[model samples]
Target: MIYSIFTALSWGKDLTHLFKRIEESKIALAIFSGKYAQSKWCLNELAKMKTLAEKNKLKVIPIFYKVKVDDVRHQKGEFGHNFWKLARTSSGEEIKQWKEALEFVSYKMGLTLCENRYST
Candidate 1:
């Protein structure tokens, strides 16, 4: 089964409900793109996934979609630019958490889809 924020109808459900679903799921796929780090909601979901992986042994598969793994791991290039832009309006603690989550996922072994894959 696939769970996507855009497709999921979560009118009254809180993030805890989403996290709980993540925790219960057998596998979680995190598709990291250029603007992924710019959204607080995305960062929070990733952070929760990381925590669940460590504590509950939930498996997380990171997929780099047209983005460099190094850029995500180190927060450099486009990912860095977008993240910093979001950081401007975020608290230090929030930024720290997002950074930590990015760092954690970056180190994991994942598939990377380069620009050529999507090019015509």
Candidate 2:
């Protein structure tokens, strides 16, 4: 069976639904794109995944798609800019959690899909 928050019918449900799904998942893939940090939901999910992975309850595999791992980790360049934009509108504690999550993913063994994958 396949399940993902990405496939959720509606987020109108309690946020716990998302947390439950994350807990139920054995493994999770966090895809980091240019605008990834711009979304609070995405950051929150990554935070959850990071927390579970820390406890050995879940395995997280990060995918850096056209975004540098350091950029996500340190919040640099465009990714950082967007993250700061989100931060300005978010709580300090939440931002700290998201930053930790990004840092965790950057050090993990995972896939980095850069541009020109189809090229020589």
Clash statistics: count for each candidate: 0, 0
lDDT of 2 at 19: 78
Give per-residue CA lDDT, model 2, range 48-86, as digits (tens). 888998999888888888988889989998999999999
Residue 12 in model 2: shift from native, Å?
Answer: 5.3
Top model number, lDDT: 2
After superposing candidate 2 on the true structure, give the runs of residues whose Cα lies further than 4 Å from its correct spot: 1-13, 118-120
Residue-level lDDT tens digits of model 1 in 1-120 = 334542165435778777766666666778889998787778888888788777756677789998888899888889889989999999999888888888887887778888677311
Q: Which candidate should be chosen as best, given TM-score against the real structure? A: 2
Error of 1 at 52 (Å): 0.7
Q: What is the lDDT of residue 75 in candidate 1?
A: 83
Q: After superposition, how far is residue 40 of candidate 2 from its true place, in Å?
A: 0.6
* Candidate 1 structure, TM-score to reference: 0.83
Per-model root-mean-square deviation over C-alphas: 3.4, 2.7
Global lDDT of each candidate: 0.78, 0.83
